[model samples]
Target: MSNDTAAQPAYFIAHITVDDVEGYRNYEKGFFPVLKPSGARFVTYDDNVTVLEGERESGRTIMIEFPSEEALMTWWDSPEYRELAKVRQAAVTTHSVTIVHSLPPR
Candidate 1:
């Protein structure tokens, strides 16, 4: 693909607090399948996360890296993911999701 199509890498961050563990587990089961096809990589996922500095939301924090913004959006907007999201929405008490562009290499 051309550079324009292949663009810069992107990352997705989500801070979530689960109210229903079983329901969240169900969401987890279907998470990979939707992400795998879009080449998303799990950078980190931690429930026992600590705040080194500044304000941090309460809950499990997850960071996922994608090959590009397009890939990230594709995975997020996919029909499979949409279905899985309902499970996530029903399970979590708080959910914050954001996409960030990676800095260019020096």
Candidate 2:
């Protein structure tokens, strides 16, 4: 199966709380290269987040859209991302990553 082909579109969403701001910056810088080959596009990155309801709140919210689940997984499991994840792990105190599928266009 090709990287671009999948049953549906997939999105990666992350809610993060950074413990080391400077270290997080470094992680952001290193992330671009890791994302480039994965064909993932940034949907949003908001540091100033407002919690409307839930008990859980994060310092930042990020969303990335991918062509397919396969491509998303390929990127997530790739060596480049694995190495970069170390930087993210060190910088953030807490985070949640989720994968969601998009509904087909009408």
Candidate 3:
């Protein structure tokens, strides 16, 4: 495959605080299925407990790798996923989403 075709271009990290743990668990369980149709994949979907920090945080951290910026946007705007996002917005009090480009092949 050509580099353009084979290369996945973006990494996204999310720092989140869930207001309702039960609701967040339900939301987490539902995310992958919605994302699968858009061809997004997770590099890490770690909960806060395993994270080492000065203080324990009450939230979740997620990292996802998308095939491209376009792919990431596609997933974000997808009807299926967008609809489900309400669960997250309602449950999460504070959150951050960051996207960074991957280093291209030398």
Candidate 4:
């Protein structure tokens, strides 16, 4: 068969750090459902990492993948989610939400 994965949807990765793991976990529990309505999914929320050439860490990291740019924007712009953003901001010291198209398909 020919390659069928060419038609799959892409993703946006959010490489972030949280100062308080407990607070972040609470935020995730609360906000995760909010994101699902906008087609956001947690591909990997890994805490274990090896920092080779980056700032020293004291917070947790997150990686979220959206289906597409439009979908990511949908969640980002949604009023419902916007209101809840403070929870995340307070929970984490800093966060870098980056959007990149997923390679191939997932």
Backbone clashes in each candidate structure, one number apiece?
A: 0, 0, 0, 0
lDDT of 2 by residue, 1-106 (tens): 4433475779999988999989999999989888989888989989877778777765888999987898899999999999989989999965689999876545
Among the numbered candidates, top TM-score falls to: 1
TM-score, candidate number 3: 0.76
Q: Give the higher-lDDT candidate: 3 or 4.
A: 3
Q: For residues 1-106, could you state the per-residue lDDT of candidate 4 as single tens digits? A: 1243423445654555666778777777878678888666777766676788967555445667766666777788888788777777877766566666546644
- Give me the runs in candidate 1 sitting further than 4 Å from their true place: 1-6, 104-106
- Clash-forming residue pairs, model 2: none
The numbered model that scores best in lDDT is: 1
- Select the stronger candidate by lDDT from 2 and 3: 2
| TM-score, candidate number 1 | 0.87
The TM-score that candidate 4 achieves is 0.69
Which residue pairs collide in model 1, if any? none
RMSD value for candidate 4 = 5.1
Which candidate would rank higher by TM-score, 2 or 4? 2
Candidate 1 C-alpha lDDT tens digits along 1-106:
4576567889898999999999999999988877889987889999888788888767898999999988888888888898999999999965678988767655
TM-score of each: 0.87, 0.85, 0.76, 0.69
